[model samples]
Target chain A: MRFDVVGLGVSTVDLIFTVDELPGREVVQRAGESVIAGGGPVATALVTLARLGAATSMLDSIGSDFFGSFIQREFTAEGVDTGGLVVAQGRTTSKASILVRKSDGARAITFSPGDAPELTPDEVRVDIIRASKILHLNGRHWDACLHAARLAKEAGVLVSFDGGAHRYTNQHLSILPQVDICIAAHDYAAAFAGTEDVAQAAKALLEAGPCVVVVTQGAAGSRVFSKDGLDFQQQAHRVDRVVDTTGAGDAYHGAFLYGLARGFSLEASASFASAVAALNTRALGGRAALPSLAETEMFLQHPL
Target chain B: MRFDVVGLGVSTVDLIFTVDELPGREVVQRAGESVIAGGGPVATALVTLARLGAATSMLDSIGSDFFGSFIQREFTAEGVDTGGLVVAQGRTTSKASILVRKSDGARAITFSPGDAPELTPDEVRVDIIRASKILHLNGRHWDACLHAARLAKEAGVLVSFDGGAHRYTNQHLSILPQVDICIAAHDYAAAFAGTEDVAQAAKALLEAGPCVVVVTQGAAGSRVFSKDGLDFQQQAHRVDRVVDTTGAGDAYHGAFLYGLARGFSLEASASFASAVAALNTRALGGRAALPSLAETEMFLQHPL
Candidate 1:
C-alpha cells in the first residue's frame, strides 16, 4: 500500500511501572502495576497516524533482542509497515523503565539506548520517501534524519521534525535547513534561540529555514509561528482525569502531520493536533491511547 | 579458594519496581523507585554464605546474555566463586520483574526463565562438590540436583534443599530423599505432605529421608523437625520497617546452613536463621540486608 507518512527514529520497549509516589532514597517500594510497550518519539508518532486511518511506514533499526522483536511486532500488529526496519545484530534494543505516578499522572522516564547501529545516508530509500506524503523524523539520528529530510525535500514531500528539548548537538542543528515544519518542546526551542521566551525562539527557528515552527508547553498549551501568516496560541485540552502524560507531544506531531497530509489549514491542523495530544494521555505509554480521527473530531467538537 | 558450600541453582536478574498500589486492569502508574539486583533461591543463599565468611562456589549454567553477565558479576563481587560457572551459548538468562508495593511492603514477582538450558548429570562437577562441606540445591533442576545430591551423599557432604510453594511438577518429588536438610515455605511443605498444618507437613517430610525438616511461615516464624532429637517452634523476628521481602527465605537457608556448618545446635541455628531472615527484609531485595554471623548473634542478643 502507498504510504501516507514515513517515520524515522529509534523505538524502545518501556517497562511502565505504576507507583503511588516516588520513594525515598534507599527505600524499597512495591509497584502497583507494570505494562510493557513500545515507545519512542517518531515511532509513537507513526503509531498515532496508523491508528488514525493513515497508511504509515517506519524506517528505523531496533537491536536484535526480545525488545527489538517486541517493538517490531507492535508496529506490525498496529498495521504500520515495518518492511523498512533493520534488525541490527549483536546489540540489545534500547528500552526504558518508566515510572508513572498514579496520583497525578506524572512520569519519570529512564531510557537506555542500545548499541543499534545508526542509519547511514546511503541506506535511505528514496523510492519509499517519494511515495509518502510526509517524511516525519525525530531528530535523533542526525546524519540519517538529514539524509531523509533532503530526500523528502527533493521528492516534494513535507518534512516534519520532532525535537523535544534534545536538539542541542551540532548534528541536530545541521538538519534545520531541511525541516519544513519543526515542532519542539518549549525548553528546546528556548535553548536554541538563546532566550527563555517562546515567541522569540519561534522566530529564530523560522529564520533558520523551517516554514513553520511550534513550541509546545504542557498543560499551558502551544505556540505556532508560520512564514505564511499563520500564527496562533492555543490552550491544552482539559481532561477530567489525566492517566499519563507520556508521549502526548509525539501524538501532537503525528496528528499535526496527518492534518497537513489531509490538506487542512495550518491553524486547523494545530487545533486538531492539540486535541489529539490531550486524548493521548487518557491511557498509558505513547501510542496505546492515541485517538482515532473520528475520536479526534468529536473531542474537538466537545472537549470536556 | 576452597568452598564450604557449593550451590547449584538458577539465578535471576530482577527489575524491582516500587509502586503505591496495584493499578486496575489497565491503569498506568509511575514507580517511586526501581532497583536491579541478582536474585534466586540458591544464588542468594550462596551470597549469604559468602558474606558470612564461608568460602562458597556456584555450579550452574546461565545463558549468554546481559542478565547472565549481571548475575555472574554480582556473585563474583560478593566473593562467591564463578569459576565453575558455564556460559550457555545462544540463550537468555532468567529474569524477574518484581513490583513492590510500599504501603504493606508486598511484592508481586513475574519471572521469565530464559532459554538457559538445565544442567545435566554430566555437567555436575564432582571436584567442586567434593571441595565443599555442604551441597546446596534449589530443587528445580531435577536431573542435576539429584545428581549433585547423590554425589554429596556418597561424599558424606550434607545436602540442603530450598522449596517454595512452586514445586508443581511431580519431577520435584524425586529430589526429596537426597535432601538431608529440607527447608521450604509453609505452602510448599503443606502441599508436599498432603496437609495444611505446618507440624503435619514437617512430620511428613521427615519420612522422606531428610534428617531435619523446616516449614517457614512468613511473619509467623518457622517450625523445625529433626531426627537428631532437635525439634522446636520459633516466632518470627520483628523489624521496625519491612522494606522488601524478596529473598528473605533464601537468607534463612543460607544462614541455617552456616549454623550447621559451624556445628551450632539445631535450635541455635534456627534462631540465628530467623534473625538473618528478618534482617534481610530491612532493605531491598534478598541479599542486600543479609547480616554477618557476628551481626546475627548481636541481633539475637539485642535486636533493634
Candidate 2:
C-alpha cells in the first residue's frame, strides 16, 4: 500500500504502572493499576500520525516473542501498514516497564531491547519511499537509515531525522548530510552544536548539514532556524494538568510531519505541532493521549 | 516425572534497565545496560527449585502474545517443566518493566497482566500434586488455587501459600483454612490480620488456620509463629550494597520453600531464606541475580 509518510526505528511493548506517591528508602507504596501498550519513538509517532488521519507505515523488525506480536497487533489495530515489518527468529523484541507517579506525571522507566534485529539497506523497499512524501527516522540503524535517506532523496521525497541523542559514532555522523530537516530535544541539539543556548544550538545544527533545524525546549516552547533566518518563536499551549510527558516529543514530530505533508507553512506547522504535544501531556503514556485533529484545532483556538 | 515441589501461579517476563541515577523532571539518563528474564513469585520459585536440584513443574497460564512466549522460553531454558502451562487464545500475557536506580538498588516497576488465563481444578493432573511432597501457590488464581490446595491436602502433601497481597476479597479467607503454611510480606500480613505489628499479624494469621505463619519485615528481618508457639526471630543479613530490591521478596520465598522441601527445620529455613534474600539484593532483578546453593550456603556461614 502507498503511504504519505513512513517511520523506521524501534517499536516496543510498554508496561505502565501508577503509584500514589514515590516512597523514600525503606518505604513501600501500593501501586494503583497497570497497563500494557505499544511504545518507541518512531512507532509512537507513526501511530500519532495515523490517529491524526495520515496514511502511515512502519518499517521495523520485532522478535517473534510475545511483546513482538503485541507490537505487530497494535500497529495493525492502529490502521498502520506493517508490510515492511520483519519478525526475527530466536529473539524477543524490545520491552519497557514504566512507573508513573500520581502527584506529578513523572515516570521511571526500565527497558530491555533483547538483541534488536538489524535492518540493512537491501531490505529498504525503494518503492515505499518513492511513493511517500516524507521519510522519518529516529536516529537508529545508521547504515540502513543512510541508504533509505539517500533513496528518498533520489525519489524526490523529503527526509526528517528525529535526533533523540548523539549515541551515533563518527561513522554514523556521515549520514547527517543526507538529511533534509533535523528535529531534536534541546539537550541533543546543545550536545550536537557544543553550545547550551537553544538559538545558537539550532544554528550550529543547521550548519552541520540540514536545511532546517528545530530545537524543542519543553515548556519554554520551540525555536526553528533556516537559511532564510529564524522563524517566529512558538510558545507551548498551557496545559492545566500535566499527566505525562512520555511521548510529547513524538507527538510534535508526528504532527509536524503531518502538517508538512499536508502543505502547511513552517511556522503554522510548528504551532500546530506544539499544540498537539501540549495536549498529549494531559494523559498517560505517549500514543494513548494524542489528540484528534479537531481537538488540536480546538486547543489552538481556546487553549488551556 | 515425580517432583519434590510444584508451583501454581502467574509467570512473567521482566524487562529490566539499570541507570546511573534517578532521572529528574524532563531529564533523560542513559542506561548502563539491560537484562530480560523470567519473573513473578511462583515462576522464580520453580526456577530456584530446579537450580537447587529438585524436580519442579510450573502450573500456570500464559497469553498467546509475544511476552508470553518469552516467559515460556525462559522457564524451559531454566529446566523447569512447562507441561502444565496453558496458552490463552487471543490474550496478551503479563509483563513487567522495571527501572533499577544504580545509586541505591531501588526500583520502580510498571506491570500489565492482560487477560491472565485461569487454571481450573479439572485441568490439574492429580498425580503431579499427589506425587509431590509440597504444593506451592502464590494466591494468583483464587478459586483454582483453593481447589489445588484441597487436592494436595487430601493427598497428604504439604500446601504452602505465598500471600503476596490480600487480593482475593473475603474468599481468600476460606482458602486460608486449607493452607498448611502461610508466608507473606509485612504489609500483606497487616492487611490480613487488620493490624500493623508483624508479630501480632503473624499470630492472627496463624489463628486463621495455617499451622505456621512467617512475615517478612524488609530490612528488619522476619517473624515466625507456629502451633508450637513462636520460634526464634531471624535478623536480616547485613550487606555492603543493596542494588535492586525488585525480587528480593520472591528470592526469600523461593529459598524458604526450597528449605521446606529439603526438610529443613523452621528456624533453619528462615535463616537460609534471609541469607539468600540478602545475597539476591546484592544485585538486581529476581532470577538474574539469584544466588547459587553454594553461594547461599557460604553467605549463611559468613552471615552477610
Candidate 3:
C-alpha cells in the first residue's frame, strides 16, 4: 500500500472561540482566545495520523470559497495529501462556529453544512483506496462511503469506521459488516446496540462484524474488546489543563490506527492513542495541539 | 455639505447563525440559517442612513484580511462612501461569531477584536466630517472620534452620539458637550446618570450638552426629550416575527439621523426610526433588511 491511511469524509473549517461564559441571552462578550482550524471526524483523524508521520490522503468535495482554500491549505501544511479532494466552484464550504466555555471546556456548536455537492460514488478515488493500508470513514457522503468501503474490502485493505456521538443511524448497520475496525463514542455504541450496557453494546457490535470494538467515554476512559477474547480498559490520561476537547476522540482513532499500521500490541496501541488524545486538548481547536510522532512517543514514555 | 453623515467607529464582519438552541455543553447542531454581514455601531447606522437615501461616509482603520474586504464591499454595496477607510496591511479585522436561538431572537456573541491599529487623530478625515450634515460617533476610536467631533462642531455640522448598551464611560462625558443629539440604550443612560428612572436618565443625558436626548428600551419602546421642551414616546413597531435584533438599535440611530437630515419633525423622525428598527429585526443580520426611504414611508402609512 502506498499510503498509510486514506479517509473519506466531510471537511469543515472550525471557528472556535474560548469565551468567559456561554451566553444565555443577547450579549456581546470578548473571546479569551480564538482559533480557526480544519475540523471533521475523519478529516481531523487523518490530520492526527499525518502529524504522527503517517502518509495520508483526504477524499471529499469542498467549496471554492475562502474557507475551502483554508481547509486545503491546512491539510497541505500538515502533510496530508489532497490529491483525491475535489473543489466545487462558487460553493460554500462547511463551517462551524464553536463557543467553548473557559471554565470547563464545554462547547456549544452551530454548524452550517455548506452547499458543496457531496462526493458521488464516481468521485471516489478507487486508486487511492486500493493503494492505502487502511480506509477511514465517518458515514458522511453515504453513497461514496459505502462505495469506498466495498472497494477497500475487495482490495484487502483494512476499513475503519468512526461512529461519532449522535451520528449513528439504522443505515449504519449495512456498512458495519464491511468495517474491519469499529471505534465509537459511548452514545453511538448504545444507540447502535439498543443497550446502554457498555460490555453488551461492545458484544453486539462485535457480533455484527468488526473483529475489534472500542467504546469511548469521555474523561472516564475507554474500553476495548475484540472477538478473539481480548479485553482491556485504557484510562484517560490526565493533563495539566484541557483547554478544549473538540477532537480528543478523533485523535484517539488516528493514533490507534497509527499503532495498528505500525504493528503494535493492542495494549500499546490504546495507551498511545490515549496519550495522543490527552495531548490534543492543550489548545482551543481540534488540531491546534496535535503532537508529532516523536512528541507522542516522548509523552508515552513520560506517562503524562 | 457633500455628505449627509460622517461616522467614526470600528467595522466588523458578523458571522450569524440561527440554531435550535444555544448549546450548554459539548454538542454539534446544524444551524437553521446562517448569514455573513457587516456589523458595527456606527457602521450599521451609516448603512441605515445610506439605504434611506442619505449620503454617508465611514471613517475607520480595518485590516487587510478577507473580513476587512467584506466590510468595505458591504459599505460600497450599501452606497456608503469608503474613501476614508484605511486598510492596515496584514492585520486582521474584528470579527464576531453570533449564535441566535430560533425560539427567541436572543443572541450569544464571541467577538475577536482584530489587531488593526486604531485610527489616530491624524486619520480623522477632517474634510469628510466638515463636509457632512452630521458627524456620528459611538466613542470607538477615542482620539479620532474626539477630533472628528470637534472638527464637525467647528464647521457647524451637527454632532450625534450613540451611547450603546453597556458602552458608557467617563471619557464619553468629555465628548458629550460637543454633541448636539444623543441616543442611548437604557443601560447606557442609567450608567451615565447613576439612576434607573427613564425620565431622570433622559434629563441628565440632555444636561450633559446635547439639546436632544432619546433613551431606548428594547421591545418596550423609547422616550425622546429635547431641551426645547419637545417630549414624546415612540412605541416599538410590532413585526410578524423578530428574526434577529443584532442591529436594531443601530438602525434606529441611523433612521433618526435620516429624519433630521430630511428636515422631518422630531416626532416624525422617531416614528420613522422606530419603524426602521422593527423592520431590521425581520432579518438575521444588521443590514440585510434595511429599508429604503420609500419603504419606510409606506410602512409609516400602514404599520403592522
Ranking by DockQ: 3, 2, 1
Candidate 1 Cα misplacement greater than 4 A, ranges: B1-13, B16-181, B184-211, B214-304
The structural similarity of chain B in model 3 to the true chain B, as TM-score, is 0.98
Relative to the real complex, the DockQ score for model 1 comes to 0.06
Q: Sort by TM-score, best first: what order?
A: 3, 2, 1
Q: Once model 1 is optimally superposed onto the true structure by TM-score, how far is the C-alpha of residue B290 displaced, in angstroms?
A: 20
- Highest lDDT: give the candidate number: 3
Ranking by lDDT, best first? 3, 1, 2
Worst 10 residues of 3 chain B by lDDT: B19-28
Report the poorest 10 consecutive residues by lDDT, candidate 3 chain A.
A19-28
The residue pairs found clashing in candidate 3 are: none
Candidate 2 chain A, which ten residues in sequence have the lowest lDDT sum? A21-30
Q: Report the C-alpha displacement of residue A238, candidate 1, in angstroms.
A: 1.4
Greater-lDDT candidate between 1 and 2: 1
* Chain A (alone) TM-scores for all candidate structures: 0.95, 0.94, 0.98
Give the Cα error of residue A2 in candidate 1, in Å.
1.7
What's the alpha carbon RMSD for model 3? 4.1
| Residues B209-280, model 1: lDDT tens digits | 798998899888998989765678977899888888888889999999999998998888889889999999
The DockQ values of the predictions, listed in order, are 0.06, 0.18, 0.49
- Worst lDDT 10-window in candidate 1 chain A: A21-30
